[model samples]
Structure formats: structure tokens, C-alpha cells
Target: MALTETPLLFEFEVVSSEDLTFIPMCVRFNLDRFGLRISLAQWQLLPYEDRRLLARFPVDDDTEIEPNFDHALFEMLRTHANVEPEWFAPEEAPAWRNVSAVPGGVANQAGLADLRTPDIEDWAQLAPFQRYVLAKLARKPEANHDFVPAMREFGLAVPRNAAR
Candidate 1:
């Protein structure tokens, strides 16, 4: 399938035509909401089709319906990789969900990258998925070269970068 056919996949994430070496933010976002974690090794073990399916899986947010993502992913892991899925407690209040303020990590990273920091109004305007993507990109454990690209993609004005 063409990469664009996978709506959750972003242009910045297209490291190669078909090499999904890194987990896309869309998969991460859904997994985070479901409170499950899959290792990179585990992800690589799945056939490309399954990886694409997981990336395409929808976030089940309807309170009135039973959520199936956790079970489906678990089965996929068990069937494909012969391993159990790891778990984490989902955040009671994820920073991205709080539109009242921009997370400090994101703001700090923007400043460090010499990009315009998003204010509350800007933050509020972002779709939840966009906010989630930003929160993940802003994390400091690694050098985040994608932050500028992501900001530009999300319609945020990033000035010329001194850090690039």
C-alpha cells in the first residue's frame, strides 16, 4: 500500500518508501491510550501488513462500547511474536489533553530549536492527535531533530533554526 494510504502516517515519518523502522506517532498515540507498550524488537517481528494494521487501528474512545484494541493487539503479539504485551498505567491526565496550557517540555524544546513557542490559544487549536505528537516529540531523552519539521507540518511558524 502507498504510504499516503496510511492516513496515520506522517510525511516526516517517511524515512524511506516502505521502511517503517521506527514506530509511527499514530501507533504510539493509540498504544498510550490503551496503556500498552510494544518494544521496537517486537514491532519489527511483525509482518509489514500487521504493522500497517496496527498503525491504522482506531482509538476506541466511546465509553458506551467495550474497547477491543488492547485485546486485539495482545492477540496480534501472541500470534505473531509469541510474546506478551507490556503494560503501563495510562496517564490520569495526559499533558496533551490539557489545552489550558502548553506543556513545558514542548515550550522548552521549541525555544531550544529557535521555533515560535505555541501559546494556550495555539495549543487549544491543535487536534488531540497533534498535541500528542508534539508532547512526544518534545521529550528530552534524545536529540529531537523532528520537532522543527513537526511544528512546520502542524502549521506552527518555526523561524530559521540555529540548532539544525
Candidate 2:
């Protein structure tokens, strides 16, 4: 996982459900980078403070500490939730990190939504979390109402009225 700046929560994801009920995308992105899989059940088991700690942990490439966020997160999960961590080694560069081209699935989803597909330049310029959010949103059409709003938030798309 590349170390780039990312917000803990995107404006598009500030809905009521996301604050505590839903796992925020930034935490999920860090978990992905760490090769950890945390179920929603396990998340609900963790106290709010633990969840806040996980949200604030640093995974940026420039951090000086060794074995920083992941180890601490694992321990926290075990201590607070009594849950074992599960791992799925992510690709060295996941789809979101690839700036060469937008993933076909994302492009297809954009087309389906009547929105512009972000070009290579746009993708290349996005913060890592923004790309991660887009990739996640594209995976299931049923949960993808946020796709257009997210794209607009990322400045990759404009509202139809504004485009006229």
C-alpha cells in the first residue's frame, strides 16, 4: 500500500449510519493495507474508544516507527473484542493504487450512473482513500447510490444542472 494522505472520513460518508454503525472507509483502507479483515460483528464488539483509536492510527509511509498501526490494532481487537484477526494479503498494488487506468468495473458503473469516468490524470491525482472509496462503491450497484456524490466530492464529476 502506498503512503498518501487520506481523510479519516469523506464528506460523502458522513451520514448517520457511518459514524458508528458502519465501518468508515479509511479504517477499511488501512485494514486492507495491513492485510487484516475485520468483520462488522467484531467491529461492533469493540468499544467506541478502541474504534476511535483505530481510526486515528497512522499508516502513512513516512512514519518512523516500526510495525506501527497493525500490531497495535490486532492487540486491541484481541483485548477488547476477544476476536482473532484474519488476514488476506492484499496485492502489492491494489486496483485503487493503479493510476495507469481506471478499473473497468468502476468505469462501467460510472457509465451506468450517467457520470463521467475519471481519466488517468484524475485517478493519478486522487488521494489514496478517495480511490479506495470509489473502488469500494463500484463493487455492488445496490450500495452505489453514493458513487455520483462521491465522484462530485472528489471533483471528478459535476452535477447535471451545473454541467449545463
Candidate 3:
């Protein structure tokens, strides 16, 4: 099926439920890229139905949507909805390509190196999504501080920062 590109009507505010704070840079990037200009109050006021609809539709290539929204909203709305978020690093993400095969790029770099061991049979037990998230997080230098904490929370092994 051909991918249908849709224009956005409502601007999104990148508010962190964890912090109750908005990341202005991320917000501006989404707005400028998607042609949206939504306020915090406006976002809060949106009915669940409308939010569900917006989340189901595809934005342009440059826009960023909430990760959970990308997965849950689309899957709930339509079987054919493309649920992948723009932030998702592709299989060939730079970090994955650059690291040695032994390290295996992002997954290894992110402290999930233990995942690569054949002797540790449990390593193969992680869900694909967990593996994907771990790999993506490993390659992102910006997420380094949060990566180990997230790994612990997710029951993944932590990697030491050799640079420190």
C-alpha cells in the first residue's frame, strides 16, 4: 500500500509527564516541521477521540510524536496504521554500523553487551521491542546518562562509560 501523507491541524507540545515540563526545543522542532501550533491548554483540552485520531494519522517525515502514542494510538485505531515513531532509529543507525561486530553497535554500546553472550541463554529471552529500545539507546550519546538507569529499570545489563 502507498503511504499517505497527511497535514497536521493541531500543534503538539512535547510535555514530559515525568517532569510536568515541556522541552521547548523538541516542541519547536515538531511544530516547525509539522506546521502545528498547539498550546499546552489546547493539548490538555483535546478529547480522547480527537487525540486518538491525530495519533493515528501520519505526519510528515520530520515530525516527532510521543512514543507511546505512536504505538498504542495507531494500533487501537486501525490495523494498518503505521505505528513506528520518527524517533525510532533504523536497523542501520550509525552507532550500530560503527561498532565492532563483537560489540554489535547500539545494543552493546548501551550496556546490553551481556545480551550478546551465547552462554547466557537468558540474553535471548528479551522481547524484540526491549532489544530494539536497548540498541537505540546505546547509540545515542545524548541518552547516555539515562541509558543505564533505564536498563536497570528494564532489567537489562548496564555498560560502563569508558570515557569517564
RMSD of each: 4.3, 3.9, 12.2
List residue ranges in candidate 1 displaced over 4 A: 1-7, 16-18, 59-66, 160-164
Query: What TM-score, over all chains together, does every model reach?
Result: 0.85, 0.81, 0.33
The CA lDDT of each predicted structure is 0.76, 0.73, 0.37
TM-score: which is higher, 1 or 3?
1
What is the per-residue lDDT of model 2 for residues 50-142, given as tens digits with 9 covering 90 to 100?
A: 676666655452324434667777788889877777988776766887888898777877887777778798898998778888997887655
For model 2, where is the 10-residue window of minimal lDDT? Answer: 58-67
Quick one: best TM-score, which candidate? 1
lDDT by residue (tens digit), candidate 3, 117-137: 211333345443334334544
Q: Candidate 2: TM-score? A: 0.81
**What is candidate 1's lDDT per residue for 29-48, written digit by digit as tens?**
77888778989999888888
lDDT at residue 115 of model 2 (Cα atoms): 74
Clash totals, every prediction: 0, 0, 1
Q: Arrange candidates by lDDT, descending.
A: 1, 2, 3
